[model samples]
Target: MLIGSLLDEINKKIQELMGKYVILDAYYIRLAVYKAMNLQGTRKDSSITFMVDDVFYVLQKCIRRGISSLNTDCICTVINHANNILLTEYTEALKKNLSASNWTAVSQHLLQGELNNVSGRVQSENAQKKYITHLNDVESSTSCIIILHNESSEILQKMYLSDPPKRLKVLSCLEAFLQTAKFFDSLLSETLLKTCSTIFYKLVDNMLQGLLDLRYVISDEELLMTEVNDPFMHAFCDGLKQVMQPFKKYMTDTNYAKLCRILMPYIARSYEKVVMQMKFNYNGALRLDKDVQYLLSFLTNLTGISVRNKFYRVLQITCLLTFEKAEEAKEFLLIESDTERWPFTNKEAREILTLRTDYSEEIEQLL
Candidate 1:
């Protein structure tokens, strides 16, 4: 009975020390999490900020200290506090800065690396760096959350809980950071949408469609003379390379892929809209087919994603416009292409055929 009393006293003192430890560290944990969002002194290099590393390093230290007591409750205490700090101080600061960046106006009608007069946000080099750094911060935070979770789980596996179920119970507390990761993901996508879509569409409007839509397809001879690699397209390719360079340098590969998925569909829709509006003779259709192929090649090579599916309608239009026989086009559409996946109906294909200036009356009879 005397030994039992002394054991109780020791456990009670351990609990007290754990409480004091968490209380003492809470202030610094919050401080470290908040300081991670110090946008003002953030790196201008657009790399992942050291602040992210610092925040997690501090958390690791805190977790190490908290777990030394061998009390699961103590570990839970530290984790809950860190989770609160991340969801509140860290996430709120990111959201607040993103809100003020006027993300919606960041890339309005940017062409030839120049912002249109209507664009409120100037695309200054420094501003772009800062914006990219903010994006990188978000991505790094998300990535670090996964790394930290794995690290925490491993620490538990080896040191804290030998049983998998109990280990997972403790790890369940770590899932809170997954919510933070998801929030950062939404922010990253939102920023990319606000900036990249307009920038790319402007490149299309000025570089690709500007040349195609200029009423230059008046005669067959000029259409035949139109080289696949027009100076305008070359310029568009160069401009596209310039547009993609910064993203490659700064964005995580996963987010960079997200950036491409965001842009490609918008670009495809833009291409399809422009192609539908233009008058295409036989030579014009032939030249445009090559031009589309060229563009698809460049973008596919750059992004390493098969974007041909996105431009499916554009390809169908080109096929209908350039096909020598109506029956062959019908067979191709119904048999060669997947019926459910065909972007256009027979009626739509007929409508596209009407855009062909040099087409005979029978071209519309494909259906």
Candidate 2:
């Protein structure tokens, strides 16, 4: 019993000492990261930077030493700290640099000639390049994170020579970094969407003004205009497509697809609003359908997403404009009884039905 007690005390002392050592090692590693980050602020010279190299150096050093020493707790401590740093401090740093570029507003201004002076245009141009560089940095960061995770796991297998289960336990101790990589990757995608959206919607606001002019077309002109000669109408969809085209060369397929899906609903809603306001005669209603179909086809090819449902509301409004009688429009809304509901309410239906130039006051009241 005395020997057992002695062994117990020795084991406990050993653990306490290892704990102190491991904690101190992780602290120094974190300090190294902070020092490196401070030394390398907002570098645009490369996709990867000194800060990334420094962080991975310490991380690999920490994990390799822990595995060689068979110190499980040491690896866990280092990985947890690394994960925390990447998600919070590292993410904040990237976001700060990206925001400073003013990539969103600058895109619109650059295209619109809103940057007047030579110096102002040059500065804005530099800022735009910086934003693109920051995005590259994010992509490179995610790649580095993944490569580190894989290499760390390989080091575990080679050094520890453990069975699958034991290796899995150690790998789980490092999984936080994997999750951090995914998070950084997602941040890259989200940032692209935001920048692209800022440019896209700005173009829409400018171009839609010209497009809304169709609402004022005299009835005779509407039937004669051949589906609205307006490039601005095409600019509505094609402009967004144009905005995203440059980024396709930079983004991963998954990132680009997500950007398309998220932004598609906004386009649908905007087109629906514009279509609802225009006064269409019987023939102009035909032109409206033609225009909608062309835009729909263009959007489908551009986004590589199923967009028909997104424009279903616009189609519904087009149908409302085509009806020969308001009573017919009302019947169309009620025909299904309860199986499928139209997106708009009855009052909204009446409002759309009234936009048809041929619908008399009595016909409008019938809706």
Candidate 3:
């Protein structure tokens, strides 16, 4: 009774919001569906299924008509609802003694089987095999959306992609990626870790490189320049950072080492470009606090590197930049602790870090 009432309330709220404008932002629609599904979870299957079907039906209609007022929230709610409802059902079936892997496989088959075409069948099969496949797909879709998203004002982009559109389709794909990653990470298998590593490296590589491309894509525009600035860059960076957590959680040292290897070159090239642009002459030393913090955290979280050595190396370089103009030294300082600590002589790093007026004795000791 309560579930029924809650679903009614949620539906009413969605209608009210939709009534405000000729079309609403896609996020609001999605938010409504999420709320409705949360309420439906309190009920029995028949009722929940009815709600799911209603949402799917409405969203699919909106998609065909190009009524984007339906937005990402609606699609997100639908996708999440499907996964949650199925997982709950799967768990119940397991309690009745269904083999866990069999439950997973069967559930996958059912979801994929419902699709009418070969491509959808293939995608679902791939998606089900290891959730990472879904993640990669979403990463690709998000990349595509980021390109179009920068074309106009952020508001217009939100409107363009909201509800039953190509953009929302991609956003929902991303949300599915997040949900599926969480689900599989709980299973904790070696194969799963390996698959996740591959996915993370590829996804991060593409997203980072793609964001770089986006800067040039809109290089001609003045208003669009802000789109490629810190906020946008950090969003993609955070996406990769979050995805890496599960891999770090399961495998620890080796996974972290691998991630650093995968990320280092990209990071090096990227930071090098930014660092080189900063003037090293006079008092123009670049402060790499934010970027260094992100890189170091990702490293330390993934590896068991000794903290003492890490910060000492950092302090050493910061001191060096105080006197001499060494861009290379600054670049090394920016590297994560897990990165193969380069072969900078302790003597050199110390000389740089010493920042002393009369370090002639210290310099002579190194020689």
> Tens-digit lDDT track for model 1 on 117-198?
5342335434555566667778888888877777887787887445676666677887776877787788888878867655
CA error at residue 231 for candidate 1, angstroms: 3.5
Clash pairs, model 1 backbone: none
| TM per prediction | 0.85, 0.73, 0.26
All candidates' lDDT scores? Answer: 0.72, 0.71, 0.41
**Model 3 whole-model lDDT (C-alpha atoms):** 0.41
Error of 3 at 287 (Å): 3.5
lDDT of 1 at 220: 61
In model 1, what is the error at residue 115, expressed in angstroms?
A: 6.9
Candidate number with greatest lDDT: 1
In terms of lDDT, the poorest run of 10 residues in model 3 is 40-49
TM-score of 1: 0.85
Model 2 ranges with Cα > 4 A deviation: 1-17, 20-24, 31-61, 64-68, 115-129, 136-198, 215-230, 235-238, 324-328, 360-365
Candidate 3 lDDT, 68-118, residue by residue in tens: 445444444433443443245422422232122232443334333456677
What are the runs in model 1 whose C-alpha is more than 4 Å off?
39-46, 97-123, 160-165, 202-212, 215-220, 363-366
When 2 and 3 are scored with lDDT, the better candidate is 2
**Deviation from native of the Cα of residue 192 in model 2, angstroms:** 5.1
Candidate 2, residue 293: how far the Cα is off, in Å: 1.7
Instruction: Return the clash pairs for model 2, or none.
Output: none
